[model samples]
Target: MFEACLDRGLTLKKVLDALKDLISEACSNVNSAGISLQSMNPSHVSLVQLNLRSDGFKIYRCDRNLAIGVNVASLYKIVRCAGNEDTVTLCVRDKADCLFLTFETESEYKVSDYVMKLMDLDVEQLCIPERDYSCVVRMPSKEFARICRHMTQIGDAVMITCVEGGVSFSASGKLGTGNIKLSQNSSVHEDEAVIVEINKPVQLIFALHYLNVFTRATPLSKTVWLSMSADIPLVVEYNIKDMGHIKYFLPPKIDEDSS
Candidate 1:
């Protein structure tokens, strides 16, 4: 059995919301300092790592590296019912079941047993190999969100062209093209609008949905970190805390003519 507690209630709520946006309907893995959800939405796009340390919570103690792959939708429902802004305590009881308890007054609400259709999800522990990245961009979370909202109007995919100067988020389709530029100096604090320059341009195309999922953690962070290279997977990272961070990678699209 594994259990943990937090001093602030909203931190749990934020983490749950961030996970809910990415966690798949199929399976999930929770381990020391991290939780990962793979192949929950589509085949080509999957998230492998999410660090909870930035939220000021770490593994108090783990008898073993517990891997619980459950239906994220089921977990989401249970969390929703537990109410918002309440101190949350989560425990995994064996490999078969998990528990969510909320404390208020002298009472604790057990919400997990209320979930009738408990999915028996098989857990697959994966080792994600690291790769060297050429370009990195750091910018405010709110500005990134604004760029996403604007780019959605143009197309299904956004083309991120990275260079030494900075990164540009652009989308073009039948409607037209929309672009937002972010520079390294852009403040992750208080500033809503941002623009930046780069040294050499490395252009890549990514599904807007994946970008949306990765950037969802931006609001919880002061800034977002992006690492990319020409015709390679892009890594988006947010340092939530000194010990924890969230890293999201999206595979680049291959062009037939260029190849």
Candidate 2:
């Protein structure tokens, strides 16, 4: 059993929301993910990693060189209950039970029983073999979210085409065509909008539902980064403070006519 506590209540809320979205979308295959936390030397930078191991899904973890696919929703809920204060601490009682305790000046909240079901989760981390990617894009999280939402209105899938100039998000269905283009200067937030750019032109199609789930982490991060290759899987990285980080991988669509 493991338990942890956090001091900030708002951070807990954001983390929970993001995890919920991941779990809901990653419902297919096994329904859980493994989470590990390691401390940085100065105790300032914290590394929280979530591993979803699935033979059908794939992702590249740069540090461990591992590829994994697994359900992440259950793990998200488990972490959400771990702490609720500004300063969070975690503990494991046995191999199966985890507890999360939050402390305020005069009050405390115990959320131990919530993580019980996640104990039996069977998750594996694969060694990710190296593969050169053709394109990478950096954009505002909110802007990406807007593009996803807009494309979703047109069809069940969104076609993403990356070019040297920029990346284009488009969806076509019976309703016609819906497109959102982000260039090197696209801004999602006035004060913090990061520049968007791509290295080469690579086009891939992704499911709208998955995009929606992956972008849920946008509210937690200032910007979102995407790495892609032609007909290869798409990687979405979400950076969260104090809590941890999440990466989502979606297999590229081969049949555009069917999508």
Candidate 3:
């Protein structure tokens, strides 16, 4: 048996909305530690990882480890029926083939329950090696999303250059070329500041299309962390407040110009 309750139904809805575009279905592993999911997009060009700590939930319990396969899009539809302020609980019984969802209002005046069939998905766990990144940038999530949106409009690819105290995003296409630079802001609150830490300068090119997809997670957090290194995947991470974090790994485009 496994059950976890979130304080707000909207939180779960936001998570599903952010993932439905890239992954239609995936398995969520629940254990004593919490729940986690790691899946690659159908195109296999990028990977997404999510970790939700058990303590972060309003109430959580696990009798044993369980891997629950879910159709993300379908579940999102059902979750949307719940009110934003309602409490959301996900429950699974032993030897059951379906997952249960319950939504309740604070005043106990309203309650809703839904059951979704589980799937048997064969998903392998990948071993991600630990490595240090040459450049790490912490900036506002909204700003990153805006940059991705603007760059994608200008070109199919974006060249990211991280220098000492600033980072620049540039794109070139038939229409024209555009570049936007952001300098470190130390006066602002840490969450809103644009902070850059670099061991050495690095310039890399990535597909703006996938970067734009990653931006769908912007609503999950106020700040985003970008980690990049030569010949390695770019790590875009958004911490879910006290819950956990969701990270997207996208490899850089090699031997190609921004256009």
User: Top TM-score: which candidate number?
Assistant: 3
Cα lDDT of model 3 by residue, 1-259, tens digit: 9999999998998888878898988999899999999999999999999999999999999999999999999999999999999999999999859999999999989999999999999999898898889999999999999999998878999999999999999999999999999998879998789999999999999999888888888999999999999989999999987899999999999854345
Listed per candidate, the RMSD to the true structure in angstroms reads 4.0, 9.9, 1.4
lDDT, model 3:
0.93
Estimated TM-score for each candidate? 0.77, 0.67, 0.98
Encode model 1's per-residue lDDT on 26-119: one tens digit a residue. Answer: 4545555544454434464656466554135433434556555555556666666544545556666565464545444224543223423345
Error of 1 at 23 (Å): 3.5
lDDT on C-alpha atoms for all candidate structures:
0.62, 0.55, 0.93
- The TM-score of predicted model 3 comes to 0.98
Is candidate 1 or 2 superior in lDDT? 1
* Poorest 10 consecutive residues by lDDT, candidate 3: 250-259
